[model samples]
Every structure is written in C-alpha cells, then in structure tokens.
Target: MRKTALYPGTFDPITNGHFDIIERALRLFDEVIIAVAISQDKKPMFSLDERIEMTKEAVKSLSNVTVVGFDNLTVELAKAHNASIIIRGLRAVSDFEYELQLGYLNNSLDDTIETVYLMPKLQNAFVSSSIVRNLLKFNGKTDHILPKEVQKIIGNMTSCTLH
Candidate 1:
C-alpha cells in the first residue's frame, strides 16, 4: 500500500523552511499533500486562493505532492486524502510543546492517524510564515528565506494586509 502523509499549515507565505520539510517528506511517504488551512482567526495576509497558488507554484518541480485548501478538522482532511501520517515541521525548541500538544490532540481525535515531526535544514530552521510576513511588512530582504516564486507573488501585491 502507498503511504500518504498530510502536511497542514496556514502557510501564510511559504518559506524555504517549508520547502525543506516538503522535500524531506517526499522521501518518507509515497505521496504528500500540503493542506493550506483557512485560518479565520489568524486573519491571514494572503487570501486562501493566493496561499494555495503560491504553494502550488513553489512545489511545481516536486513530484508526488499536492497543494490544497481545507477548512475542516485536519484529521478529516487526512481521511479525505487517505493520508495515514500527519507531517509537522519543528523549527525550534519553542515549537515542540505546542506541536506535541497538537500531536496528542490529533491522535485523540483519530487514533488511526499518526503525527510525524521533521526539522528543516539549518539555514532555513528559523524561518517561518510569521517571520516572512513581518519582514515583508518592513520591506525587509527575505530572499534568503523565501522561495523565488513566493517573492514574485508577494511583490505583485500593491498593499500590506497585515494579519
């Protein structure tokens, strides 16, 4: 049987860190799905469409990966995609507590689903969606952290819609 994994996140603006995780994920699972969350509470800077498009473009070269927008329970999303594993990226020690809580919660919600944590490359480790947004707000150089495709999409925008 093919092993499929679901990687869910707001992905307000996908960073190199995200690419790192996805590329690494491709190695472990037969197929990987990037679930872009519709986080109403976060009031995202990028629209759901924009986030999905951005993710699609960024991962275009990669095989066995899908980019999708979802607004339901993650486990439900996983089930819909037939994903048995949930992939989470851990960038720092601070992220562990929250991610661990989420792992347990998701396991409680569906004991059949398993959560796996992976870390990005060292250079991309500290990069995150929030940090990318903050840098863009100030016209900061994010070339080191953002994928070229993301920089293009974000550049085309005419205004700042801070979350």
Candidate 2:
C-alpha cells in the first residue's frame, strides 16, 4: 500500500516555507497532497481557485505531489484521500501551541488519522503567508518569503506590479 499524506492549509499564496515543508514531506510519504482549505472563517487574499493554481504551479516539478481544494474538515479530506497522516509545518513555538491543539482535536475526532509536524528549514522559519501578504500590502520585498510566482500573484492582487 502506498503511504499517502495530506498537507492542509489555506495557502493564500504558496510560500517558500510551504514548499520546504512539502519537499520534506515528499521524502517521508509515497505521495503528498497539498490540500487547500476553503474556510468561511478567514478571508484569504487569494481565492480558492487561485490558490489551487498557484500551489500546482509551485509544486509542478514534484512528481509525487498533487494540489487540490477541499471544503471539508482536514480529517475528512485525509480520509477521502486515503491518507494516514496529515502534514503540518511549524515555524515557531507559538505555532506549535495552536497546531498541537488542532492535532489533538483531529486525533480525537478520528483516531485513524494522525498529524505530523515538520519544522521549516532554519532560514525559512520566519516565512509565512500572513507575512507575505503584509509585505505585498506595503509593496515590500517578499522574494525571501515566497517563490517568484507567488510573489507575482500577491503583487497583482495588491495592485503592485513587480518589475
């Protein structure tokens, strides 16, 4: 049986940190699915379709990685994809607290699904979707946090054309 893992997130724009996590996850799982969550609670900068396309483009070179949009809970999505594990990225201690809580909740909701956390590469630890959004809002350079294509998308959304 193939070991599959689902990486769930809003991924308003795919960032370098996200790519790092996906790359690492691909190493552990036979297949990694980048699940973009469509949540009503949060208004994302990029639409679900946009996020899906961007994520696909970001991971286009990875044969074992696939991107898809999901409206269901992470556990449900994991079950649907036949994934035994859910992959999450941790950038700092603060992120761990919330992620740990979510992991516990998911495990409680479905004992068959497990959450695995991967720390971002040391240099990309500070890169986050929110940080990239803010940088684009102020026309700040976000090349360090996001891939070139993602930076371009955020720039377009914020009406800041990159040269």
Task: Highest TM-score: give the candidate number.
Answer: 1
lDDT of 2 by residue, 17-98 (tens): 9999999998899999999988657888777898898898788888889899999888988998899999999999999999
Clashing pairs in 1: none
Q: Which parts of model 1 are misplaced by more than 4 Å? A: 159-163
lDDT of 1 by residue, 100-155 (tens): 99999999999999999999999998899999888888999988898999888888
Please state the error at residue 149 of candidate 2 in Å: 2.6
Query: Least lDDT summed over 10 consecutive residues: which range in candidate 2?
Result: 154-163
Q: In angstroms, what RMSD does candidate 1 have relative to the true structure? A: 1.2
TM-score of 1: 0.96
